[model samples]
Target: MLSTKSFKGVNVFMSRNLVPPEVFDALLDALKLNGADVFLCCDPSRHGHNDFHIISSPDHEKFEDLKAKGCNLLGPHCVLSCAKEHRSLPKQGFTCCLAMDGIKVLASGFDMDEKVKIEQMVTAMGGVLQTKASVDVRFVIVKNVSAAKYKWALNVLKKPIVTINWLYQCWNEHRVVPQESYRVLPFSGLTICVTRIPADKRKEIEKIIIQNGGKYSAELTKKCDKYKVARRWGHIHIVTRKWFDHMS
Candidate 1:
């Protein structure tokens, strides 16, 4: 399986496989944002090609697709060994010959067992193991923003660790139904849940959601739902399980 690892805040990788275009783009964007550099290596022979070409110019006609996606091509140099140098240089280098500075190895197509061995070596040297999913880092609004904002609050409620169901009950009590949505980002393991609610009531719950770290849930259950009702008639009621039981 292909996976990613982060080492000393650098991105490094050796791969015989290529990641999806979107995932690759995400990785480049993240590297640029974090001031990390990249070293991509592949064996042209493994790809079963000999007449290979490397495009280095930013506006190179051969790399229109990669350029359009904001990837700036640096100089291309052949990976040569003592024997290979005596022969004609291939367009691309083998995985072993590729090396660069300021790069923390990111992803590899190595098998799982080998990857674990590599990971152990890295961690032993104080490096970190990032899931292949996280190699392509992307921004997440839920954990990235303050919970006081209702949009973030909704996210907190949906997180796995926070099993609060009261918020959902509050919305239901106010006749508000939250439409369910999920965002699967390149970098995150869990699909982020986005709920739709009325604009005005957002501030009511956003106040609490950000304060809790992805550990809040919607209050929709009788066993633990705790909702507060605010009526235009100035009547406020603290909803509890007993009330739900009594009604049942």
Candidate 2:
């Protein structure tokens, strides 16, 4: 449960351009319900509220500056997306980490249960876990953006740094989401091709890819990325949607 005291005198800001408009509305509503001094910076004339102030620009870097002034970030990945958003999510039964197999990840600044959840998320995603950051660590998941590991991943290795929410969002969507929408990034890049699915669903899959900073091709090429199919394509990289769902 949220308490007014928890949010008292706290200023919360989110990047309007990074968050989809629909999601922005819901996020604002949720924050308001929680008693947050929440503000969304976009066109100021629109979305004015008695409860919070609005910044009229899309300069997302303002959010970083606000952090220095004691503002809390509360949006998906705490960034805006330059990708297209689909009206619908992926089909159910599909889980989060189908493309994650053999990938390596590290978790930092999370408690024991949260740490276990990270391990489970990676393991379910078919990724290996490491004790600490290393050359082998491809994904670093953290709750606080200020964590050392998160900073190191973003600044030093330039690897994918993502929030724990990335895992939950991926689980809900049943496909890997775009890294740009995360606080850090869950993966470097992923590409997928589909087969044996309805035409409408194929489009949804493509939206998942594009919104997450991946390129999609209409036709399968010999040298393209992974292919998604119910059956194997003569050993061309592939995984059944059922298997992808079971990855969680």
For residues 1-248, write the lDDT of model 1, one tens digit per residue: 11332212333332223433434554444433433334565322322222222333223443445334433222222122212223232222221122221123232334568556544333322234445323222111222222222233334333311111222232223221232332321112221112344657545444433333232234333343133222332443434434423422
Per-candidate clashes come to 17, 9
TM-score for candidate 1: 0.17
Residues 100-131 of candidate 2 have per-residue lDDT tens digits of 64678888878788887677556544466788
Check candidate 2 and list the clashing pairs: 18-80, 18-81, 77-182, 77-183, 95-245, 161-184, 161-185, 162-185, 178-212
Instruction: Note each model's CA RMSD in angstroms.
Output: 18.9, 17.9
Question: What lDDT does model 2 reach?
Answer: 0.52
lDDT of 1: 0.31
Error of 2 at 228 (Å): 60
C-alpha TM-score for every candidate: 0.17, 0.34
Candidate 2 residue spans exceeding 4 A from truth: 1-97, 184-248
Model 1 lDDT at residue 18: 40
